[model samples]
Target: MNSNSQAIKLFLVVAFSCTSLLASLTPVLAKPTPNRFDAKTILAQAKTFNQPPIPSGSPPKIRLRGGGKRAFNQPPIPAGSPPGGRVRGGAKRGEPACPTPKIDLTALVPFTQEANSVINVWGQTTVEHPSWFFYVPYTKDSPYTVEFVLQDPDANEVYKKAIALSDKPGVIRVSLPSTTPGLAVDKQYRWFFTINCDKQKNSPPSFVEGVIKRVNLSQPTLKEIETAEPLKRYAIYAQNGIWYEALTTLAELREKNPQDPTLKAEWRNLLSSIRLDDVAEEPILPGTP
Candidate 1:
């Protein structure tokens, strides 16, 4: 062989040797084995493993030490829970804290008399005597005493009293003092109810932050009619005893004067609408006014 051919033969041999070495070094990766243990065997192995004991202490506990695998088991909660503590409301822990009682003045107004018959038209006649209605809801240990307070807009207390012992929600009714006989008709009032839960007093009675509903006995008065021109028409309608037209005219008047004409006429119509009992006809109408 010539020198060049001999060199080519030598190069071929070197390349084959390098390829063989590389093939030998390449790693043959093995496949992972599938877990084939039966359920019973797995359970037995879990039983054989030892679990670490729980570190017992007060709430907000922190774990500094490592612990072995264990099933989750919670501590039992005590009964007659005190304030500021979590109470269970459902299957979940620490939910739905106890609710506070809310006292509200549904209304405060004058006692109207249609021939000595007091009215509660706002309550749709379901309520009588027209006193202040307060709704109180409470849940606490036995013998809870709550105070109800009535005051003016200026924060001058008008009435205050303590109510005792209820395991559930309750309604409190108090008669409005007729100090000035008709003072309640147009005046604004404020009220609140405080609780002494388990003989431990809570925050002072909270003020009901809303307006008080007032009552008026007569149809929009003469002065009110001037503010709303349509009311004069309604008064004339009522005065003319045109019942249907007066009723139809109300819708138009209501848009202009919701306070005076519409409300007053609505109330008067309610009084004349439903007759609770039959009235006996006087043989001759008792002399007309």
Candidate 2:
């Protein structure tokens, strides 16, 4: 081969190798994203799972905060305050605002490995800090204190706050503030929703705990949700098994369109799918978390 020809061939070989290397590295860093589940496909599927493709067809066990196995048999919201606390949301005339028992503190999640009369559930998220929900059976006037704690995978404290809950009972949500540290993607996080009924605050408080894993969504998938109709976002989130955002999106929609019959039915169906039918018909109380 001529000198010029040989040099040209060498340069071409080097260029091809660099291209191949980049191609290989690209996939390693860029994980595969989920395909957009459009309205047609979502409608075709009658049920939306807490999370689909669960290995055992059941939810994975929730990660307990502080690795403690302590169980609170007492009601999360102890019943002691006066029975009459000014019925605000048309609560029944005779219904006990604070029941002696039958505490119905529930975490709004699908995957639950155990419920020892309290709650333990887990799910995934695509955002830094996602919102969590619960079905509170007590009114804001009820005698109780609320505390929410978030911990990282290493069990390190990330954010902790004592929330002041108001408004009539039903469903409520807690979202980490903008200043709170964002959850790292791929790392697991654990949270505790403890309602301290004891005046001491040191007693073993009844709580609902859940685990969360932050995942990444592809650019296209992100774009679709951001640009699509506001209500459509909920369906897409549900189809992808993103419980946190799905529930939040649905809740917000319900707040704006309380009379939306379709949303009302969907709210029931989503809760029913996870066997939370007891609080299925409960109102999504309007308020900031």
TM-score of 2: 0.63
**Regions more than 4 Å wrong, model 2:** 1-103, 114-120, 201-203
lDDT of 2 by residue, 160-193 (tens): 9887766766788889888998989877777877
Clashing pairs in 1: none
- Model 1 whole-model lDDT (C-alpha atoms): 0.35
Give TM-scores for every candidate, taking all chains together and pairing residue i with residue i. 0.28, 0.63
CA deviation > 4 Å runs, candidate 1: 1-130, 139-141, 166-168, 177-182, 198-209, 219-289
Determine which window of 10 residues in candidate 1 has minimal summed lDDT. 276-285
TM-score of 1: 0.28
Per-residue lDDT over 1-289 for candidate 1, one digit per residue giving the tens place of the 0 to 100 score:
9999999999999999998887776544344456668798787775543222222221111111122111111111112221111011111223222243232212211111122332212111111112443334453364446565656546677666665534444333444444523225444444444444333332332222222323342455435434645545444433433322333344344434545643543534322222210110101111110
Residue 245's lDDT in candidate 2 = 81
